[model samples]
Target: MTVMMMKVFHVLLLLNSVWTLTGGERGVSCHFGKICVFPCKFSPGDNILIHWHLTPGNVQVHSFYDNQDQLGQQDQQFKGRTSLFLDQISEGNASLKLTGVKVQDKGTYQCYTSTMEQEAKTSNINVNVKAPVQKINMRQTENLIICSSDGIYPEPHLSWSTSPPSNRTFQNQTTVQKTEELLYNINSSLTLSDREDELEYNCTINTLSDQRRASWRRRPSVEIISGEATISCSSPDTPLSGFSLVWRFNQRQMIVTKNEDDEQRVSEEWKQHVKEVSESGRLTLQHLSADHEGTYTCEVSKDGDSSITQVSLRSDPGKGNSHVVIGIVITLVVIAAVIGLVVWRRRRGSKCTKSQKVKKRENNKLEKSEDNQDEEEETKMNSS
Candidate 1:
């Protein structure tokens, strides 16, 4: 058993906590408070030493030698508590065994080799503990569905989808909340036209199970729109994949753009002047602004959902509006800056002013010389 006793804890920088380098000692894995065993991945004739030291509080842990008979072990904190599984050492498996584990062991651990040809190699291992997700909930309001879920492990992902996979019409809201490590929740709403018939809702949470990820779905049928800006959230009957998404502006219907860029720009423009879409196939106009001050149309169909919104700037001639006043203000600022610059340059020093004047005079002289040359060329041409 090789235990290096130091005044402070010291962990090796290795690539793997459990691997073997071509010329170094092997790797190892051991838990806290229990008997941790490791193998030295090296031949019997190898001239090397195996050592272990933990540094949560600066303490020399342990060490062992291969060819030479050397002994410089640590204090009693790690007497019978540490050792190596020597049987596999000659095979180049340098694994360390720890008899006891402390909370201070909750940091990066490594296994390394410093022999010839193998160069330097190590391994780093990060250990963590997590829980599980056990519950999910979803509620519907108007044309939007607020999805809430909890009791998840390994951080669950939240998404809105179709229950039957028809890819029907719907919008996603942006309000979300994370309540716990294993729990999360978000709320999204869709807009529906008074003409729409049905809407289905889906909320999915993804988490880990047996080191594998599993997806859990929570779906609920929601209400249909009976008025403006309202949407329905319910599953459709014929598996909605074929249904076209519809959009409307104010009360006018519009067409959905097939090109992706056009759709994205349209959506961006919509957010600027309108509400986003909800899973219920209804487009929402978040807040009314002067930018939102125009005739809008919502278009819905079987292919996709889109909207065309107009905007009008309300003008008040009596009291100059912000846009006009801002321009005047900017013009005044520029004028002031120019005046300040002129005054500063002119008053800074007579030497600078004189230099500028000389430069200008030289430029004028050059122009006169060029002009005279051109005139003389013309006269010479006439004489010829």
Candidate 2:
């Protein structure tokens, strides 16, 4: 009897080793701060038991017994964040649902379950948590181009590349900061070459789960000489089959919008300025004056990804020259008026001097005549 009992014990040990080595292993992924469900199953029976533990430390994540949750020894880190499907437990579903998942929650989990008349079963689940990279913003100020993104996890990476690839190495700076929520924010800037030739810049943010890219090409301000201009949404060679395009002026006013159906809508306020939209999404603007001198942004969106191109507009140099010419003409008119007033004053003064001299001469002649008359009267009186 002792020999038989030892043989049965050895058989049980071998069976246990096999189960430990070949337990169901799978991977599950969930986003950070979201719910994650760890799949598990067992045979249906009376008085079911389920327990979930973190591997390596065997930390208790959740437990179920007596047809209810038994969390007396649950880990503090997982308290109030772990749950089981109570309604689905009797059907042999031993899945554990975790809420508000954190970065530290990424690990291997062990789900153990048992029943009154069935052997205990174990499953290993590898959990992966991710915070995907979102909207990347790219802008340029003179020769400096900046790109940034916020609220990403797993420490995103930033890289810069240029189109029409240049041989000259670019100088760039990058920084990463942690937010209060423990997510990452990345920023990078690139100093472009002094050459004014057209070049396209691309900024990319990469993570284990997702990647986002933004492309921009700085264009010199357009000087409209003919009171009209045509601004292309993208390169003439780019395909616009499944894309939607939007044209905005100064970032607020919507100038025109085109959808995938090839329908174009122009804002009422921009009707006079927007002349036509071509099949390739080129915008022809008419009657462009000083009021139209600002930034015009073209956004192309397809499948949730967007590419933006910006063009700055300015009134014709001749328009500005007209202002300068008007100022010069006004100054010349003022100077001419001043010189004409001085000449008229000098002529009037000379005329007044000549008139005074003529009056003096006439007075001298009258005085001489009066004196001769007085002498004649005296002589006549003496003769009488």
Candidate 3:
């Protein structure tokens, strides 16, 4: 019934008397290899207590000595892996060090402390044991291949597979430190085979989160022409579970699938017109004619974001026959005229030099003569 008890009881009553603040709080968080401090500052005689516990209703991970020995059952997953920086506790350091972290270590952790007057206040700590983002750096180590994934936590697994999903040889070494937390360093390697599909090697790092699996992909690549004719193909960096290739000829459409209905009638349009280099995404047409011109698009996709390329094929390189030829010739002539004007301007003016003036006058006369000749030719052609 004292002032403090009245206020404490009132606060606890309002807090549902759980003596704990459950939701809506800036909880505890730490990177795998870094030191994370869980604040647990309580007045010496506040009748409040603090400790750490796990779910499935377990005992404490560790707690500061009220003045003597530490108490509470440390989590098994966290056993021999965590240590309360006991030195800082007296000065208010509730930080814990988690060592040799694994991918399974990421989760929501709690920091609970009770106040006899009020209620138990709990803070949440989110520990993220991130797997290294597989970095694909291709290297030829004297016929032995070298690919690495740095800048990651909890050393990751590196793998190489063919598109048809065949296992290959690889070796990896992981180094870790408690002082550095779970800041894991891994050097994985395997004697890569010298295959014709060398560039088709894919490296992936696997990790799990919330019962979901995830990965990154680096697809094999090739550059192809847009039109006339080109091959839309890739060897692939990783093995594919399934495979399909299609060529589309809508001129505007970029994907065209092969006809698969009848077992015998398999030859499509592009196949008849274009020949591809075996086992590669390279194509060659027997002859590139004007009519064979249209946008030839290549579609390549695996997992997500299939790529479609627009290859512009030309029905006619510029325009068509005689009229177009004449028009082009006229255009070229106009462009030359403009270029001559610019050159003359830069030369300080055609009028400034006597020789230039003479050349200009001669050119004007020549132009007049050329116009007359052109008119005569046009009249003759029209008559013919």
Candidate 4:
């Protein structure tokens, strides 16, 4: 045999020795619409061949052969979504980063790496894509009612409903947006009736595997300009101890917290503005300014049940209260005037009835006299 043949035989023997050497299968969890990485590492070299395949069909996802990436046979579903750490490949890192992970991508992946001598090392990764975190929000401006949600996956479906059926047709507007992190953000709006009474609104977000719903009913709005503002979240009287209250601003910054033991904590930025923390989870902010205008969320937990309440705050404090008072006063004055007018009409109707009765008696007396004259004329004719 030639000398090259002898070296080839020795390398083949070495490959057979380490062929069964492999790490245990690892479990990987990935969020839907997010990036998922399957880790594989080895000694850095250019003579290594890495092959990745998905089980159940043994579909080739990616392959690095002959010192180059060979992807002509990659599955269409994983096209453009699969990537290898090319920069670190020379350093023996064969990790794959999969972007925009979907439910269909959940399965077992095999990483097979072989050196120039055909010595092989294998590793298995079981990937699971998780559902996205969801949150729903609602807002109202004059006659417009809007509902929105953020950080959802798989293109969520949104719908709106009302408690009492309204005959009026609502204008619906919906939009879906993808963020830099590959999460879906949805916004939907419905124009509401101009009714003064409180209305019940329901917003539902649906995914293929999960469905979450949120109900929002109209609450009495309070506005204060340059004055103290109070937001409250209270529950029914329960003997359960260990209650906790948390307040958030605009769904981002936490403003205050009160524990069941009556301990209080406030945010540093809002320390001066936070005036009081009631035992019932009421937050009072003093010396409010335009900067305080936003949505305030109050979360209360007792026992094991939790409740959330959101309040919208604005800066037109004086106008809102004054308008309410003026509207009440105007309504009261109009009602009083209507009552006075009704009383006047009743008195006039009574006087008119008395006058009609007197005229009717006079007409009856004249008719009787005429009838008496007619009877006397008839008697004289018979006697003649």
| Number of the candidate with higher TM-score, 1 or 3 | 3
- lDDT for model 4, on a 0 to 1 scale? 0.74
Which residue pairs in model 4 clash with each other?
225-317
Q: Which ten residues in a row have the lowest lDDT in candidate 1?
A: 219-228
Kindly report which residue stretches of model 4 are placed more than 4 angstroms away from their true locations once superposed. 1-29, 33-50, 54-131, 163-170, 178-183, 222-230, 234-265, 285-384
Tens digit of per-residue lDDT, candidate 2, span 1-384:
354554354346434633484468999998989999999988898767777888767788998876789899999999899998888888988999999999889898888776656666777899988888767877666678888998899899999888888887879999999988778999998997776338778888999888888887756677765678888877764658778888998867899998988788899999988888877777889877778888888878775466778888887666644766788899999999999999999999999999999999999999999999999999999999
In terms of lDDT, model 3 sits at 0.48
Whichever of 3 and 4 has more lDDT, that candidate is 4
**Best prediction by lDDT:** 2
Q: Candidate 2 clashing pairs?
A: none
The deviation in Å at residue 285 for candidate 2 is 4.7
Write down the worst ten-residue block by lDDT for model 2. Answer: 6-15
- What C-alpha lDDT values do all the predictions have? 0.43, 0.82, 0.48, 0.74
User: Ranking under lDDT, best-scoring first?
Assistant: 2, 4, 3, 1
Give Cα distance to truth, residue 290, candidate 4, Å: 10
For each candidate, what TM-score against the reference? 0.26, 0.68, 0.32, 0.45
Name the better of 2 and 4 by lDDT. Answer: 2
Order the candidates by TM-score, highest first: 2, 4, 3, 1
Model 1 lDDT tens row, 39-124: 33443334445555443443445565544312355646656665666675555666666655443344433444444334444443
